[model samples]
Target: MCSGPEADFARSCVSSITSSGQRATLLTADGVRIEAARTPRTPPPAGPAGAPADDLVIVLAHGFTGALERPALRRAAAAFAQRAAVITFSFRGHGCSGGRSTVGDREVEDLAAAVRWARSLGHRRVATVGFSMGGSVVLRHAALYGQGEREGRTGAHADIVVSISAPARWYYRGTASMRRLHWVVTRPTGRLVSRLGLRTRIHDRDWDPVPLSPTDAVPLIAPTPLLVVHGDRDPYFPLDHPRMLMAAADPATTELWIEPGFGHAENAAGPELLGRIGEWVAARG
Candidate 1:
């Protein structure tokens, strides 16, 4: 079922909760040291060679201030590792990764680095699966690199995206609770956190807010297929957020699936949901 026999199929998917494992090592790219845990995978056995591996090239990005070893990212990584190659990494400044996390701008670069790492290992297809702020990075990466032609499927770019409970607009979709959280993040409290040296773990330093939010980025991913899945009950990003994504995406390709009662990233995605995701990936393959 996996790329290899037993658990060896996946060397290290960022999914496991055992954060202390060797797979949690950091790799440097473009002067930035980013933490990445590798997960091995292979295609379904019934399929031909070069099929998407059981170890999907899944790059997991942590939510805001979340680290490479965040419990949620780990669990989600593990869940996806059941079918694909998984790579979970800490965004610059979050967790053990280096550099200051600049909202979603610099983080997009980090995501690119992660994807490059996965591609180097012979992965046939790659995807960015993120949560919350992590989801924003996934969208940005797809819009940026998803362009160009496929030399057959071998040279095609990895544009598959999955955002769990993410808001299209951090500025407008900000909820009462989330808005309050951002207020603290953009104010003296954030500065205090940075002064106390917690800056490396979160958005401790305030930066100029950008109008280039998800709504702006969504249009760029026209040709690439997008899968915008969210929890209808998500308190942070309402159903309207995914609706906006569907409205913006190339209706001929992009698809949106809204779960009935899922919460945020930490919640479990059982067979039903994972099955849906797996089916989508297979169809794309």
Candidate 2:
């Protein structure tokens, strides 16, 4: 949502700054290397004797062109860590991760890998919080992994899913930002600019069989709590996208939050909002 020269400069600074955490190199099931970081939860004040530490982990899936090192994502991680341990990773084709971005498709494997990693850390519960393109992936990931369909890796499923600023369907050119994004992924010159300016490597081939759309995937996420969040002023996707998702989900378990003055994804998310999201995960995940 940021624009103009000042916003550009601020974005540059935020992207350049590195986040502090325990760094690790992860390999997805498809054999792609992923750059990841884990920020341990901040221990709270002493409580009753023999009370256990927080056993929940939040796996953060950043939007397109976002990375684990970006300051905006780092800040979100820090905020969430106050309530639970946080895991942030760069999707393949972004940051130092290896592989061309399939946009949203195939990214489910990446999220699954992160969720499995969370379980390996001895966490009793795993929550997925995704933004923009990541938002769609979380929905699909929960649907795919929730049913234990992929090689019986039921361990990869998320206990809870949070999607923000995600589109409902594919090939939507409803907004200027989305139109420009399509150009960037579909044209050679635009891809070059994206590589040099955004550091995001996109795949050239189109989807063979278009994967399930976000709205269609929402219904399958039932039983496992789902939260759909969108900004009133998001330039990439409109309010209708969230509404469609909500309509597809079970009203009994799914929750929708329409942020009043929010913009888009990680860049728009601040400490207060991130803190509230963390609290929601702790209470519900």
Candidate 3:
């Protein structure tokens, strides 16, 4: 956790720079236009003894029913921006982005675009922090793109990966929250409610070939540092979810933090925890 003064400085810096984020309209491989905002790293405090400027950039991926301007997302971005530049974007169908959500399938492309944008902005070191549904997308995207760098294929790759409150497998309905989420994705009436209440449009079809699960993607994230954070008290997924992800990840390069009393996603994340996450990413760099 950060001290009172550091926390206040972080909030103040973010408040002043949040509105000045460089707005970007990124087009995914499948032609979806994703609404993204990149808040450049806050300038170091004045004076020779001030903190050094950071070169790494952190890309934040929000969960279902979340947008770039969502309060939780903004708070997380601010915390990260205290240590590095931050990019927050809306997945298709969530905010002002075009196209419907295919849940986690096509969302991988959305993350890819954001990562590319980060690299284009002159930051060679990039890290991704995702929550809930966004968490799963990070895993899959890393597996698909990160591996390409080692295999001589071309694509955007993240230097580090952090997944919070993510599920290891798909089609899980073990919890009431997940059950409700399934209803929202599978039923027309529930979809209507999601559209009207959440402004999220669900794709009417199922995954064609069934995209790889988070567990399947975990093994492929080796060589790139991975962090798995989950809450014991989360209503959406049980302990088994994070456990499965950790088990599949390369133990030598992976870090696992099972918070005792945390809940789910960005909503449950506090400024202190977000500050800690920024520190962890900086340490890796």
Candidate 4:
């Protein structure tokens, strides 16, 4: 399966399963410590025959400054668990995870670590659903790991990818919210506020070599199914971002949803919309 160093650690990592679910400490390829939790699907109501279980697992990636314990993220995880097992983790620089956030860059290794853990749990299929910053990470992860399996990149591949409220490019200052976010990540004083107020640790260093952008990554995800969901009322990124991502992807394998009244990522997603997303992943993943 996953042959990288991270996957090696994932395979060897000890996990404890309880009535609640499985919990463990994961090590990324770069030795970053990550906190992760797993929740099995909620059993359906009684019927003539019990609902057949599927081997699908969903790995959720949270937006910038978001964590597994956040109420919004917890709610989203619960909704997805209705259809399949769910894995939610705090990326490095957030929560108890060790490391600094390089924003969307290098976070792909954190996601790979989680996916390898899912495989270790014996799940036959993996679906990744990411929100905002996490959305961009999923697109890039799919491009790098979804394909090239035969070339020795295997286990970390996602069968289906769902990106919600992701941006097409980097360093976007078009929106007031984004401009403020840039300040938070770039200024020392703003970073202090982010640490004390938002509890997120951002890396101060800039990218030496820029990673692939979401639009560029989408083109390489051919044959892998992708779902891009965006909100017209989103404050961080505009409709143009989602439109560009869809345009870069293969039409035969891509699906786009532009919600009229929806706002942003997990925080803005209502129960009804989350249910629909769960259904979509269940049907295809």
Candidate 5:
């Protein structure tokens, strides 16, 4: 790693005002135009032979009802961009993107498209960091790639995966919030919202036409390096969620990092944890 006042600082959404960065619009397979910001490195850093660029691209996905530039995600993007290429995006029906939240089912397509875009850039290793619903989306992508659901990529090419406060298994009972979410989704009113195509929500209070869950598919991503971070005291998914997810992963390559007293998203994530995350991904290469 190199040093400078510049390198000391990461390129976040706020810092983007002074750098070369822009949003990339990709119309997903479903025809909804999901929006993502690409934080580029004017000068990519050097690494070991065949190593990821100094500015490895990290695609960030937000939790329920979050925008591409949510304050927490922005801070994280800035922090990680200090060491890699970081991109953050809003899922459909959330932020400025079209359509409503699909509760991780339909959002998988959006994530898949984003992964494709990252690959198109010729980056040998792309890492995905997702929070909440975004984590669900990332996990789903791993499954799709794991099983060759689409084009058979199984994202076997991706060098790393980072998930924070994600529900490793859906429809689990430990959190009151999770129960509420299930209630909302199973309710008639929630189904109506899904039918109407509403976006800009964290929790989809509606019915999803294709509600394939993460728990049901997480096992498919075996052999791929996995990092599952969670807050032990989180009232949302609880510590057990990540534990369950790791159970399905290869123990040699899987890591479960528990943050004390953290919540369900990126806001509470500390610099130490962020740096640890960077070190983890970097070490994998």
Candidate 6:
């Protein structure tokens, strides 16, 4: 447990490790230039003489106001990298990626692009893990293109999905954090603040077609393994959100874990939890 300047330095070192990953530029179906990185897995200690190493890839989708360089994102990526190859990317409006954010609406394309890139890299299996707004993106992406079914736009589906601290529905302003987020995305003044402070360019208009809600997308992710994780004390969306997602999903294929004291998203996701998630993803492969 590092703190103060030491913690910042530690995070920077971790960020450098994540940044050392092979960088790639991915074009979404909508022609958005997405910035992505693929971190190769660290080789395990010699076990048998020539045991084949696991070839699994985990694509990480970060929350609103997050990017590939964010310390939390880097830390999570490093943890996942311990068990499998890890891919991390900034969804369009954040970091070096192009275009504006439509929140979770068009971001599904971003997640899809990252997953496809991972597949193209020759990984035998690919799993998706998302935090907050990204959580919603993974759920919708899986719904649209999971279970070996390919949509014309997004070619491949993720083999496994994990959603953390995601909202069940859109336009939810139940908590102070969410209310502030709504303001940031809805108002011009808030958008300006977001641009200057958060380095995010939010789309001016509302979602055109209104992409599927996480709960609505849940039922569609059958035969494809799904894990819905949420903090019991999450401020943005209460336990109802994960409960709603789990209820809508197929019981046989979905698993739910409501953490006791966890807060929200990547910031609250400690290394221990990330390791467990990596283990879970590895088990799937």
RMSD of each: 7.9, 6.2, 7.9, 5.2, 8.5, 6.2
Question: For each candidate, what TM-score against the reference?
Answer: 0.77, 0.89, 0.90, 0.92, 0.78, 0.89
Q: Indicate the residue-level lDDT of 84 in model 5.
A: 71
Question: For this target, which candidate reaches the highest TM-score against the unseen true structure?
Answer: 4
Flag the better candidate by lDDT, 3 or 4. 4
lDDT of 6 by residue, 111-224 (tens): 988988888888868899999999999999988887436436544688899999999998898899999998999999999999878978788998888888899999998888
Flag the better candidate by lDDT, 1 or 6: 6
Q: Which 10 successive residues of model 3 have the least lDDT summed?
A: 1-10
lDDT of 5 by residue, 75-149 (tens): 787777766777777787665565656677778777777777776766567887788888877777776765674
Model 3 regions lying over 4 Å from their true place = 1-19, 43-53, 150-155
The positional error of residue 111 in candidate 2, measured at the CA in angstroms, is: 0.6
lDDT of 4 at 56: 92
Per lDDT, the best of the predicted structures is 4
- Clash count, candidate 1: 15
In angstroms, how far off is 255's CA in candidate 1? 0.9
lDDT of 3 by residue, 1-285 (tens): 111331131122221234667876788888887878898676666667534246689999999998887999998998888788999988987776777889889999999999998888788888999999999999999999987777653548889999999999999999889999999999999999998788787898989999999999999999999999999899999999999999999999999999888999999998777878888887886
Candidate models: Cα lDDT each: 0.65, 0.85, 0.86, 0.89, 0.68, 0.85
lDDT of 4: 0.89
Q: Which candidate, 5 or 6, would have the higher TM-score against the true structure?
A: 6
In angstroms, how far off is 163's CA in candidate 6?
0.3
In model 3, which residue pairs have backbone atoms overlapping below 3 Å? none
Give the worst 10-residue stretch by lDDT in candidate 5.
Answer: 1-10
Off by over 4 Å in 6: 1-19, 45-53, 147-155
